[model samples]
Structure formats: C-alpha cells, structure tokens
Target chain A: MNKAAASNIYDILDDLPLDSGQVLTGAQIAYETYGELAADRSNAVLICHALTGDQYVASNHPITGKPGWWERMVGPGKPIDTDCHHVICANVIGSCMGSTGPASEASDGAAYAMRFPVITIRDMVRGLMALLDGLKIERLHTVVGGSMGGMQALSLAANWPERAERVLVIASTARHSAQNIAFHEVGRQAIMADPAWADGDYYASGASPDNGLAVARMAAHITYLSEEGLTEKFGRRLQNRKSKSFGFDADFQVESYLRYQGSGFTQRFDANSYLYITRAMDYFDLAEEHGGKLANAFHGTSARFCLVSFDTDWLYPTAESRHIVHALNAAGAKVSFVELSAPNGHDSFLLEHEQLDRVVQGFVE
Target chain B: MNKAAASNIYDILDDLPLDSGQVLTGAQIAYETYGELAADRSNAVLICHALTGDQYVASNHPITGKPGWWERMVGPGKPIDTDCHHVICANVIGSCMGSTGPASEASDGAAYAMRFPVITIRDMVRGLMALLDGLKIERLHTVVGGSMGGMQALSLAANWPERAERVLVIASTARHSAQNIAFHEVGRQAIMADPAWADGDYYASGASPDNGLAVARMAAHITYLSEEGLTEKFGRRLQNRKSKSFGFDADFQVESYLRYQGSGFTQRFDANSYLYITRAMDYFDLAEEHGGKLANAFHGTSARFCLVSFDTDWLYPTAESRHIVHALNAAGAKVSFVELSAPNGHDSFLLEHEQLDRVVQGFVE
Candidate 1:
C-alpha cells in the first residue's frame, strides 16, 4: 500500500479548544497502528512522538524509506511487544504529516498558515484524548513517549488521569527551561528571517524557507548529542580530506555530519510546523497549569509512572526526571525512576540501548 | 580623541607566511596601549583578546560606544597592574575592528572578503609577534589571555618561546573539541545560508546578512553561558508582558535577550570576519601541530605557565585545563593550574570574580 492507504487519519467531529483561546474546526489527526486491538481494547498502547517525529513508530517511513523511529523498541516480541499489544502512534496537531496544521486547509478551503492558533502540550494531549474517544478506547494500557513525546505523556497523565493506566516518560521535562526556550527562539528567528518564508504564506510560491529551517535544525541537533559522544564519533578528524580546506567547506567530520542532518531535516519537516511545535513546547509548564505545584498536576492519579533518563542527556538531564519523580512522590503516585548510563545523550531514547530496552520491557510487562 | 586616533594601527614591513601556504603582504595590526613602557622595556605586558575582541581592551569601544571589553580587569589598579606595566592588547588579524581581516582592503583595493586566506591561532600569534617587533619590544613580562586569546597565548609560548617570560591561559582549550567545531559550523552555515551574504561579497551590497549573523551570534552566545546561570537569570520569565502573545514575538525574556545580543553583535562585527575567526579557532590543535604529543609543544620551555578554568564552564571545562597541566608536567615546565568556582560559565574569565582576580594578581606578581 502507498503512504495514504497505510496511514489512518481521524477527523474530529467537534471543534477543538486551544490554550490560546482559539478554536480549531475540522481537525484531523494522522496515526498508524500495529498489531490488533483486543476485543475490550485493554491491550492498546498509545505512543506520542517528539518534535520532527511522526506516527510511523514500528513501520517504514513513507518519506525517508527508513524504518520507524522506534522500530528497535516497538515490534513483535520487542520491548513494546506488538505481538500481544496493539500499538498506536499519532501525529500531533500543528504538525504537517497529514495532520491539521498550518499546511492544512481551513473551513474556507485555504491553508491556515500564520492564522493557525498557537497550541500547548495540553492541547496536544486533548487531541490524543479525542483520538482515543473516537476509537472507543476509554483507557489505554500505557502511554509511552520521549522528549516532546514525554511531555505529552505527562500531560495526558496529569490532565486526563483516567486515560492511561501506565505512563512511560523518557528524557523529558514537565516544563521548558530558559535555555530550552532560548534555543527554540533562535530556531524560530532563523525560520522567520528567511525571505523565502514569506511570513509563512509560501505554500503557493513553490518555495519554502529550507535554508533557515536547516540552520535551525543544525543548532537543535547539537543539543541532542553529548559532548563526549560527539568527540568519540567525529573528533577533529577531517571530512574526506587529509588536511583542512582553510575555506568555507565542511572540513571536519562533525561539520559534514551536521550539514547532512540540517539538510535532511528540511525534506520531511515543515518550517512553519517546526515553529509552531517548538513554541508549544516552550510554553509547556505542568506546574503552572496545576496552580504552581507540579505535584498538584498528578493529584489523585493512580497511573503507574515509569520515568527513564540518560546520564548524558544534557538537553533534559537526569535532574529534570528527578524533579518529576519528586513531584510524583509528593502526589503519592506509584512511580519508578531510573537514570541509565548512555553515551548518546537525549537522543538515547530512540537509539539502541539494551538497558533502556530492558527497562521498557520490564515496565510494560 | 576619535576612535581612529585612540586605536593605533601598526603596518608590518615584511610579508607574513601563514599555515595555509598563503603569503600575506602589507598586513596591518591595530592595537591599544596603556601606561608607559619602562626604559628597559621589561615592564611590557601583552594582552591577547578573544575571538570577537579588539584593540580597545581597556578603552572605549570605537563602534559600540561602550566601555572596553576588559575594562573590569586591565586598569591601573587591576590584576594586570597597568600602573607598573605597559599593557598592550592587539586585535587578532581575522577580526574586523581596525585589523587586517576579511573586511580589509586587498592589494587590488577591494575588500578581501572570502578571497582572504584562512588563518589559524598560530597565524594570529605571528601577527602579534610582528606587532611587538615593530614596537621594538622583546616581550619580557607576560602574555595574558582568555578563551580564544588563551589559544593565541599558548601558540606564542610554543612557537616563539623567547617572546614572553610568562603565559597565563584562562578558560581555554589547546584544541577545538568536536562539539566546539560542530557549534562553530552551525554558526558558519547560518551566516552562509543567508541570501544577503552573497558568498561573503556583501561589502558593496549595502545589505549584510544581519539576520543570518544574528542567528549565528544567538547560537554561539548560548555556549558562552552556563545552563544554571541562564536559569537563575531568566527562567521562563516573560519579556515586558505578563502573558505570552501567542504569536512569534519575543514573549520570553531569554528570547528578548538573545535577540538583543544577536542584533547588537551584527552592528559592530563583519560576517566574513566571524567566519574566518571561527574557522581559525576550529583548526587549532597544539598536539597535532607538535609531533602528535601535547608535551612536545611545551618541551624545553622556560616560560612560567598558569591556567585558570571555571567550574561552570562547559565550553572549555576544567578537564581541558587539567589536560594541559598534565602535558606541562610531562614537559617539565613550571605550571600552576586552578579551577575557580564561578556561576558564569566560559565567560567567567571576562567577568568579575575575586578568586580569578587573586589568582591573576598572585601569578603576575
């Protein structure tokens, strides 16, 4: 089957209310499912994706022709065990992957573009809740996520306490820090700075702000990897050359690698979507939403929470996970926390890590 | 005096050879001097400036109309003791402020731009040495620098051991880490991605890549600051407004601060100069240059060395200083190393710190 046939999109019958005081009508959510749903829907596992991620959790990516981002973690007999559990990954709103986003048509049959209302993490979770309601799955076996995905998982646990029985958050934060917001702001500025952006109305111009988006991606890419990991992987080794070019070329292997990442991202991701999604993440503050106490967000929650953090993930360090664990403890929730030693940093969640796999399998089972 | 008069430009009377096998003729070195030189010239102290620094080390900046970048540390009663020592700080060759850089006029009477030969840290030190020779000074006292300036100090100590009796390197690494190169590459790519950049020939366009350059500065500025410092200073604080605008305005204080920094940087710095200087820093590898052994770089050195690093500095961490100390020990050189506790991160050396002040005073004395 082609990408369209393989992808399942759910159209919301009701208008979606956003934190920005705006309402979204005719919203569509794109998702992919693996395995079969149990008769009572008790074996359904909902997976949320991070920024630049989509719903292809355990299948082939239609755009890149690469395996699902979490193909290693979620498959038949894998950590998530698709053989026994039904896996569902949804593309959040404000994204361009067949979802109702800036690129999507409004009631007037035109792209929303800059007219799209700003969204929050809670709003994304609301969309997931709506998806669950549409599928007639009252409660999920588990809600799994990492990074931005983790934020969504936490949001669901906090706002819709009865939606998921288990919450698995990895390398995530309850709120965006000043540094995190600053990085996202830099990316937003980069995308807006490109003339080709045309104020996010470049859909009909047959041109997009690829260059600015690429630069933004490059900056964000650095934060995803540990310094030691980068040193081990690239070092000061020249890129396909014996000596430095002494020019503007990518002389170092790290430089070449970053360029590839920056450019490759532009192909599958939309610049406007990047801006909107990052903005949503920056505005994420669970404590603020719960009367300025993080524990209050998890009040009366019976969900079994498992939080995993990588020792080297500076983007959302172990401290962040510890903060959440403390909040969960104060809420008197049944929670398990672990800081796994990993060299890959914040991206360790999607990369190969036997320890992480073991943790996921143990927690899920 | 006008900025031109306050800035002293020295014309090198000889051709300068560079590491890239390129020869530069008619090189001009701009400098600012403080205090009077002793009759024996033994009281002369050479202060090397960092990547974006210029000759106005202890004086008013020509372009910014602000105090000198090092006014806090280089006055008469300061650590360097300008009262007893003739202090000289020269702008690096690849910088814009009154120095021979990519913005300078070529022999053909046009801006060198991208046509300028790529330079290295050692090449910058060579320019400083030539400036010293033109001043009829043998550099008897010391060479003090921080960050990129520290690289130049180390380079001078190794390549021209007889130039100075003491070398003080603060918060610096002997070589660029892979992470460092990656960040620099992001900045460079950001600049190059701008259509206004015009392949570095934007000098005559009346429109420089300010947007791209600003984004680059914003990205680099993050590395100069510690995450803790950012949190303490601007943790999720809104900018001027009580609530987010729900739009692409600078809603957060950190975003506003970054935009201010990025935009302010472009007003005084040339985009081409930034590219050249950053490229020079990335190519710096003291060990690779000296027979693949860091100890060899300091072999037979009679110069007294002192290295200071900040505990919060992730850019050039204390471990980097330790590495240098280890090599110095193996080379049988007299070296003292200190990692000061500071909240400012890599920019700690340029900030006010009693401990750093005491160390500088104690070492220089």
Candidate 2:
C-alpha cells in the first residue's frame, strides 16, 4: 500500500474545506489526466464523475479494467479530445475510489463509513478545485460531465465561476428533482436492508452487503434505461427455453440481465459510498445556494455554458435541461442548449448518439 | 378460514377443465355476490381482481378491513352499478384469497409453498367457471378486471367466448411482456433473499419473508404509478426536512412512502401468493394457446370486447391494449378500446377517472 506512498492521490486530497466548517479529515483522491495545458494553463479541463463513475474518464478503470466511462467523447481525437483540451477526470470526494469518502480510513485507521462528513456536490467540486490548484491549473478551458458529473459542473459554475471559461453539462439538472432523490432513497434503503450493512460499518464484517447493494443497483438501473430500450433489447424473451417455469425464478433475459448488472456492480463499488454520493446529489440545490433564486446561482457567471439533454432520458429528461436553460437565460449567462433524441434514457450521454456527439463536439471544440 | 360463500347474479360459471391435467384436490373457491340476478341471469357480470386483490369486490377485506379495491367503480350505483348488473367476483385460483393456491394447505396439513401446480390466467378463469357451475348460473352479462384481473377477463372471453356477452378489460394486455416477467423475477428474487423465506415454506412456522416481500412490493408499487405522479407528489422533497442529513436515510418523502408501502404490505399480504400470482400472469399467452395467432384466440367469438387503457400505465401500457384490440379486430370481433388520460398509471383504472367511469358505464350499459 505504501509503494505508491507519497504519490497516493488520497494523501494529496485529504483535509478539504467543508461547508459545515469542518475539514474533510480522511483519505486522498483518485484521478486521471488527459491532453496538455498551454503555457497559460488555460486549456485544462476538469471532468467530474457521476454516481458509479470515477477517475477513469478517458482510460480503463484500474480495478474493473473496463474502458473509461466517457471514453467515447473524451479521447485525443474525440469530442473533448485531449489533443485540443487538457482534460482531467477525478473521482468525486465521497466516492469509493482513492477519494476521501466513506470507504477510506479515518485518522484513527478505521473505515470512515458513517463517520465521514456527509458531503454535498459543492464539497466535491471544492475538492476537485483543490486538486486543480495542486496541478497549478488556475483556470480551466472548460468543465464538462453528465448526470452527477453535470451536477458538479453546475456546482462549479455557481460556487466558483472564475475556475473555468466554459462549462458543458449533459443529462443532468441543477437540482435533484423529487423523483430523482426518491429513486436514490430507495436504493439507499435497499442497501441498508441487508443485515451485513450493519449500520454502514461493515469493514471488519464477515461478508459484504452485496445482496442489499444488488437490490439497490437493480432498482436504480431501471431508471438508467428507457422502457423502449429495454423492450427492443430484451422483450419477453425467455432466458433459456420457450416454456414457462411457473416458479419464482428469472425467466426472462431482461430479468437475468438486471440481476447480473446489480450483482456485478457490488464487486467494484462500496455500499456506503452509494449512500454518500446519492445524498450529495439530493442535497444539491443550486437555487438554495443562491438563496432561493435558481437564476441567482449563475448570476454574473463568466463561464460560457452548453447543456445537452436526451429526449428519452426520463431520469434527467430534456425538461430538466430546459429548466436550466430558462434559469441561465434569466441570469443572462452565455449559454447554449440542445435536446437530442436517443432511446437510451439518461444513459444516452454515455452511449452512441451521433447528434449528441456532434453537439458536444461542436460546443467543446 | 372456512366460510360459506354467497351466490351471485353472474354465477353462470362452468368449472372448465384445467389444460395442465392436475385436478385441484380439496378445491375451495371464495367469492362475493353483488346486486340481484335477473330471472334469466342475463345481467350477471364477473369482476376479476388485480395481483393482490380478491373476490370481495364490494365487501370489506378481512385483513385490512378496507373496502373492496374496485369499490369506487362498483357498488349500488357506480360505473359497474350493482343496481343494474349482478356483479360476481371470484378469488383467483393462484391467489391467497379463498381460491385454491399455494397459500392453501396441502393434504399433509402443510402450506403448499412451491408445491402448488403452476397456474395461468386461463387456469384462474377456469376455476371461476367451475365455481359458476356449482351455482348452476348461466352467463350473459359481462366480464371485467384491471391489470391481472384484466388478463383473466381476456382469457375468459378468448377461451370461452360464448359465456360472456361483453368483456370489459382495463389497463391490461393479451400477454405479459418480457419486461413484465423481468420485473416479477426481480420481486421473487427479493423475497427469496430474506433468510426467513425459508425456501418459501415459512408459513407453517409462523415466519414470513417480510423484508424480501416488502422489497418486492416496493418495486412493484413503483410500477403502478407514473414518473409524473411521483414527481408531482414527492419530487426531491425530503420527508419533513429542510435539508439532507448526508446519510443514507429516507431523505426524500417518496422514499419514506415506498418504505412504508413495502413494510406495511408485509403485514397483510402473503409472500408466496405474490410469487404465484405474478407467475401466473407472466405465463399468460393467449396467442400461444391458439397456434401463435392472437386473432385465433377470438375466432368465432360472440363476446363483445371493451378494453380501457390509461396513457400513463407503463405496466400494461396502452400499446398492450392496442395489440389486443388489433387482434380482436383481425378476428372480426366487436371491440372497443379507449386510451384515457390518468396520472395514476396502471392503478389508474382503480382510481377516480371520469372517462374511465364513462367508458365502463357506456360499454356495460
């Protein structure tokens, strides 16, 4: 664990300033970098991860070895091409990665678990900014992300406007809508229902809260895809044979698929981190930060803004993007918005949608 | 639990033989009679119940002591007016209600659990037919139900066209889609996850798969409502909170609502019945029984069909009703379909909807 010792991102990211007048006294952060900054350091871009995403934005995740989550548009020749933009992706503050979150150790060498300060999106952005400062990138060319990542971008534009020149958000909203927060709450409850969760202190436990975590993931996973996508990909097709079993088992392929997704996720993610990240998102209310005027959050913002929404993404629908456009217009900020048609629901921003790709490419380039 | 059931106006039923070749040993059917039957039994109307509903269509539930689920739509002067029609509702064969199902004891004086023969919607209709035969009632009037109840209605009309003069199906489909089966699979998994499920044999020991059952109900309940409904009623709004606590609690009101729904459901409903009923619904395939031709199910049918769908009902969906309508049309059967706007989603059929009331009234009248 010490081989990377001094170079550990966690050591570098500990002790972040928090909103509750307390410093984040935990571990370091995990991150990845792409492209190169100009002499003015004005070309650096910070990409934030959403729930279940991390520092592997444009590279393979170390543990899972899967392609970086946003690899489709964040590579050297992609939309937020590293060749043109010095991009940086950091795992959020309250995440399972090398971030100072619930899974990390406390000063007393115990897993933080519930002891970690409940973090907000603002807190995450603050930590990211600290990382930027460490990298000597005073101002960024742009900040971009989708879903929770978009929340971070929105947070940055509102709380720290001078940190970027442009901000692009996709498949996200300025605040967690009641339904969105409700979904997260269900997921959290599912995780807690597992006996192994043990009040979020499962580090020394004999087993992981994998079942609860799986249920939580399955519930949230439904919101990530459109009914149309599910139907088209896996309709009432049986998992094995054409005959019905007439028993309580996964008969359809979709059921098995959802189960697999949920179960597989437990291996790489932490249940406590799931609770923390979701709470952070639910607590994110730009209007509240601006004293109840949503527009006020972006008032006097110099960052050029672009927002993208998917037509079928019910989780964070286009209406949510429109609301942001209305607020940005009210704030008189330079902003662009587009709602692209895609069947992937809130996941379209991370999938292949030529129009979305074009819009993001045009906006970021 | 043994009680003499009443005779009904729509008691013109036949205990049609089961296609599976298994005689339901020790069969006991529970049902309710509403209104007065005409001398010729021409006003007899059969009402089916959804997944968790029962034969007490107008009476009070013995467990929750709540009014019959469809009470608002039925009764003396409601849409399915008892004054003009003889309403007969039978507990489905695979349900917990008095009808023969897994919850019923086996010859050994033990709960059937997984031992009960896997039944289908048609099997349920067949059992109702048997109950009707025992009463010596000849049908004329109509058949009706929503969700799974609707499936039974369609099954009745398709398998025994000459029996029901009119079939009124609301928020239903001809066959359970793959997605439907998938959701049910998730639910069954949730129930099985509980240690107390004890391989679905917890009944004799006075143990219940409460946690697993609750999670199942929570997930299914979400499907019964629309996203718009969730957002409008409980959007990101915290349960009695001005801000989030940054922990994994039911921060949003909707989460609390779901938890309440899940936990409260365990108190009255049998977990095994949930599995059995959902499985029966999923196994339903009207076309499969008639040479893979949906139209063939209604071939030479004398029954007039009315299908009512709620626009927001993603569970059964308007498209599902449309498919059935198209099938009936192909068979040259008299059919009427109306897609009504309702925010309640699949459960909308059971709620207050003027159009739904008008549609059922006009069709049955």
Model 2, stretches more than 4 Å misplaced?
Answer: A1-14, A19-22, B1-23
* TM-score against truth, every candidate: 0.99, 0.94
Every candidate's DockQ is 0.89, 0.54
Among incorrect, acceptable, medium and high, the docking class of model 1 is high
Q: Judge candidate 1 against the unseen true structure and give its global Cα lDDT, from 0 to 1.
A: 0.91
List the candidate 1 regions with Cα displacement exceeding 4 Å.
A1-6, B1-6
Docking class of 2: medium
Q: Residue by residue across A170-204, what tens digits does model 2's lDDT show?
A: 99988887667766766776777777889988887
Candidate 1 Cα deviation (angstroms), residue B14: 0.5
lDDT tens per residue, model 1, B238-333? 999998899989999999999999999988888998999999999999999999999999999999999999999999999999999999999999
